[model samples]
Target: MFKGDLTVAAAYLTPAGGAVVTSVSPVGLADRAANEVSFTTSLGFPKKLERILHNPRVSLAYHTREHGFATHSHYVLAQGRAAVDLQPSAQRLAELMDASELFLGRTKRGGVWDWLLREYHQNRVFVDVHPDRIAVWPDLSASGPATVTGAPWPRHPAEQEPPKNGTTPRVPVAKLARQIAALPHRLLAYQGADGHPVILPVTVTGHDETGLRLAASSELLPPGGRRAGFLAHGFQPQCVGVSMRTVTGWLTVEDGRALYAPHTSTGMTAPPNRLVTTVANGLLAKQGLRRAQRNGTTARLHDLAARHRAQGSERQPTAFEDAPAQSTRPQR
Candidate 1:
């Protein structure tokens, strides 16, 4: 089921009763001799690694286009335990890195591969996940339904409790507004027509008191008015800090854009961890520099930071009822 897919969305529990979901590209599946469906990922994502270490229970969702047709997309969600494998032999490490390079369409002779290999040797480790339950949607058409194996499918935590007072709870307008503006990227999680969850990265084009305006490619857009989850995360190197927020609501298509009106929201911030925070920020900076070089431009993190600040300051309050606010320091 994982064939031809470059990346997967991994979700794991946080110490604070919330969850974090992030995308990671798998090097390849583990040996078939193992009784579980396992895949490997690098440890460059310190926060995800730390969370997985603290809570091994995790879920992974992969979406793939069937035969290059967006409308024929299929998805798989696997619930598993993510174990850190720190002591792989040098040969195994080399093999894993080579596989990753191939998956990313990079050749051994490429300068990009050389730089990536150096980074992997310096900061990467492997995470191997053992699936306990698996669900597959072979087609996303309206007639399709998810097929489950290994264990009974579990309902999402958000759906376990009914909304209070016949309406979804609202979050503090300013807090949600700031979070919507500060993060550089947003992740959208929604159920496909086949009734399986699909997660994809999207761009937040605009925001207001009512909701956020999302700009997604036609291929990534879900059915109109579908319930979906939106997540944003940001890190500050100078402060050695990180923040994450998730908002869920109904998404409607209008004027060729998706409008999401948040009903429930949760956010959390981590105390500064100097070493990990610095490493994470440096990795992100290097990636930004590579993208800038490829595009023949000189953009930097500070420039993006300034733009986020300007956007956050201009945010207006929403009309929703007040809710307890989470503290989020401005990114530097």
Candidate 2:
């Protein structure tokens, strides 16, 4: 839990209702005090904040081994409810300084820098999720059964009927397959019975009319068919130069094999220039804030002040304290 710098995080949504989105998320572990895990997002990113406010049920998948994050840990999945703080107190932002700088280099606050990044750094939201279920696989392959700690696992919902008028991958198979091959890293997400999303590592075997052929062990997959999100992403050292492609659609698992029918696809590519990246981030944040204003998300706030109020009297756990020590499954 402590070692990771970033995770591929999921927030649930639907098509008619919307769609679930997953992204590169960095949860500041050093700032997590008193037995809770959390990640911070810019108030500028209105869509993500709105979704979390709508459905607090979310998940974080910690599998990064490169760029110096989560290197010692096996693939871990944490599913739980998220409590959001849209209007943060100065005290909360003050508490986040150390961990924030540790993952993302030091904050450069000055004349032009302060004015440029005002909304991005100052106007932000924090989300805390206390895991109801934490599952671990031996490694990123996710080839065998996971050692889990939480409430009893739900029965496989195999008999439940699939959604009517299921969606298909709108993008051409050949085009996306090439892109997927270039970006080898992959993650798959689907909502659990409790509505919290579950994401695990997967491999792309090939592609056809059924969408991308996803390969992973049967134990890791949710049985039968359902709507799901797929992410193919890669990053260079020090989190420089990155690319990602996200797909949302139907996921069908049978005979120990799975197929992902992508309904929609979106992506971004960035070069290895830090200055350019920083500039782009500021611009995007400003635009996102405006979008939120237009959509009225800025007006609705779900305040989570319980933790901040108790900060003075509570004792925060050290990095290794929260995760359970026992492993129910054999490690390689």
Candidate 3:
């Protein structure tokens, strides 16, 4: 849709009760992630449009090359509402003018036509279409199609396949752990308690979603401090059968070697209890832990610790409390 150019041939039932032939240029392509596209056009006969479109009803159509020897005409009709927008920042207008020459391959000289051309940019209007009806058909003839049908298009064979046998292999956890441990100082940056920047030694730990379960040590986490450390781990790229979000696996680390085994019986539980409980309930179902018994533990611990944190001990409160605080704080 972003690659082709369409010419605006005419407008009907407009304010002046006449037709205008002008062109509308495509401005931008859709951001695939967000699903949106934008464009700009000129109403060549402004007086005629303003007069006829007291209740505007307009249709737009374009022809584009499709598969070999076939072409398609796309049509959309918008009625009742059309808007005219004339606000553009100086930077925006300059960029638009510059882009116009690059795209259209022409520039205007002195005269009323030049003035009109510049006004087309400076006063360029917007027609927002909220179409009540839309129809698209693959047409081979420029004369347009006489009938439309809703039928499944033909599909090529060899596009179908059966599921493969056996599970996919992952990048060994040992390699991942080594990468984290030997992670270069070039990428390390941190800030101190006073908001001044500092660099700290990196401590690597293998974690699967719920939390990082590094050995309880004074070096990794100081004895008097909270047992908290950052963890970074993701699904091995070659693990074809597993998705990072849904995979149930163990991150085995021993003697500086690590391995990720999918469809295993191991469960990762991060501390302070509640987060670990939730992750265990969701992903660790295959393990023998009973749901009712686990829920009892999580609720009891939460009730016991909720009031304790209110007394202002510990570096941070539980995750459930942290979420509400983040939401209530207004953005700057």
Candidate 4:
């Protein structure tokens, strides 16, 4: 039940191999025939796109139902490999207009609308995801077991080895804990056996030298440990003035609880006004584009566009084994 206006939390990994969770706006089932889902971002925000390019495994979690899919108590965690379409030709964008309207409301004409959304629309890059494992919980509370569907769940009896020396909290536990507590939305991201990321909502119950103590369903947290990511944020519509805290570290899940040892911490808080936001986006996009130019990423994106133009299709969806159509969807 992804709708354009519904915001969902998404996760991806950094090149160094740490999970980072963030929010994506207006995601939806972009291709009904293919059963494909996608989210969009601009070239201005190239970092996440770059990360996706490096590693395709990602996840989208739907914990809310307002203005979204069928009203149900189910919470869905969709994990899959993702493909990014760097900004393409104007014709491609034209083809996307109908779907855009379906999720994002109709477009307007004239200069005012143009001025407000110029940066937003100019270099729209779409990230299309083909889910491999979809875990549906009985309720948003994650109180019961999940009804797993799609491709088989890959198991990692012995998760990939941790770093040689092991990881510890880079940011002071007190500071990180304090920051995390201030934000209402807290999510944890960890690498699965298949390298796809698993993300689940968690509560920051407490913290110590080991890491930030987390409270989550044991079923969602693998008992053995692995390096993981933690994100805590708060936002209004469009996430204009969002304030978020992120940390990458070690994750230990056992005894129905979890612990995170943060190896690094970073965060940002932006202004809320659309005018101010657009201005800021323009400036940042300019700088990011310049960096892309210097790194030859600009040409790389153009090459991808050319390839896409030649092929002109998305990643084909796979069947969900024996599950019936209705069962494949999140159930109440």
The Cα local distance difference test for each model comes to 0.52, 0.66, 0.29, 0.68
lDDT of 4 at 238: 37
- RMSD in Å for candidate 1, one decimal? 17.1
lDDT of 4: 0.68
Residue 233 in model 3: shift from native, Å? Answer: 60
Put down candidate 2 lDDT per residue, 1-332, tens digits, no spaces: 54464545555555333336566555344233444567778766666666766566677777676655443557777776666777779887776655566555666778987777777777777777666677778877776777776654565544235556655666787787887687757888776665667677888888887688888767768777777788888776545577888877778887878888877788888787766776777778878888877876677543323433343222223322445643222111
Q: What is the lDDT of residue 113 in candidate 2?
A: 78
Model 3's number of clashes is 10
What ranges in model 4 sit over 4 Å off?
Answer: 14-17, 27-29, 65-70, 89-117, 301-332
**C-alpha TM-score for every candidate:** 0.50, 0.84, 0.30, 0.81
- In candidate 2, how many clashes are counted? 4
Task: Provide the global lDDT of candidate 3 against the true structure.
Answer: 0.29
Candidate 2 global CA lDDT score: 0.66
Question: How does candidate 3 fare on TM-score?
Answer: 0.30
For model 1 the local lDDT of residue 114 reads 52
Which stretches of candidate 3 lie above 4 Å from their native place?
10-12, 15-23, 26-44, 64-80, 91-95, 98-102, 106-120, 140-332
Candidate No. with top TM-score: 2
lDDT-superior candidate, 3 or 4: 4
Worst 10 residues of 2 by lDDT: 311-320
lDDT of 4 by residue, 1-332 (tens): 44433557789976655688877664344454555568877766667776777667778887655443445567777777777877557886766665555434455557775665555566678787777777777887676877777666666435446777676666689878777676777888887767778788888888887788888877667877777888887766435566788777888767767778888888887776655765676566656666777888768766755664565433434522322243223211
Minimum summed lDDT over a 10-residue window in model 4 is located at 323-332
Relative to the unseen true structure, what is the C-alpha lDDT of residue 209 in candidate 1, on a scale of 0 to 100?
Answer: 67
